[model samples]
Target: MSKRTIDYYTKIGILTPERSESNYRFYGEDSIETLHLVSQCKEQNMPLAEIKEKISLYYTSSVEKEKLLKYAQVLSKRMEHLEAELKEIKPLLDALNEEEQKSIINRMSPQSMALAQSLIILFN
Candidate 1:
């Protein structure tokens, strides 16, 4: 990874790479794992504020397993909701041909339609 990428992660508090004697940043396994987690969270369109809160919770808690279980519960609920939405939306999505889908998407409001587009990309 480039210095800029490392710096970006540091700025977001997702990583804290240690500096060597010559001031060269070196990321450890923990930092690399954190970067992967943060990237996955972003890819899932999780809010940065929520990610930050979760990261802080992870660090400050003694019962790490319990905290992770709670986080899993939250993620499961989100997955359930998305699945429900997909069940409802799939027929509509399937009914349209490619051009029609594009046209429908263009007419939809951004907030209402973005998740559908993301789900399409994710599932495809």
Candidate 2:
């Protein structure tokens, strides 16, 4: 928990802390948990390299799950926004003649067309 210990851990790649523009390092919840893990590992006389490997394994799964959850949240928000836009535009689209709708669809980029189709399929 001491600054020197943190410095050593950072130097050895065991603990990574965010640094400010002025170079002050900041530790958060993750760092606190890592420090506790390191202390426990050291108590059992684990080598630094081994402890680092263990922490890397821990972070790999944890970070992947965090990234996936964040992605799902962003995707959910995007889907909600898309639904709202579609609702607002539905009346206008319906008023268009078949040829006009075809013209609009033709003007869309292939990727956009594909995404629209995908969204339609998803909603149905």
Scored by lDDT, the top model is 2
State TM-scores per candidate.
0.51, 0.47
lDDT, candidate 1, 76-96, per-residue tens: 787678867887878988898
- lDDT (Cα atoms) of all candidates against the true structure: 0.76, 0.81
Global lDDT of model 1: 0.76
- What tens digits encode model 2's per-residue C-alpha lDDT throughout 11-81? 99999999899999898999999999999878756678768876776788556665556656755876777
Worst 10 residues of 1 by lDDT: 55-64
Tell me the spans in candidate 2 whose CA falls farther than 4 Å from its real position: 62-124
Q: Tally clashes: model 1.
A: 0
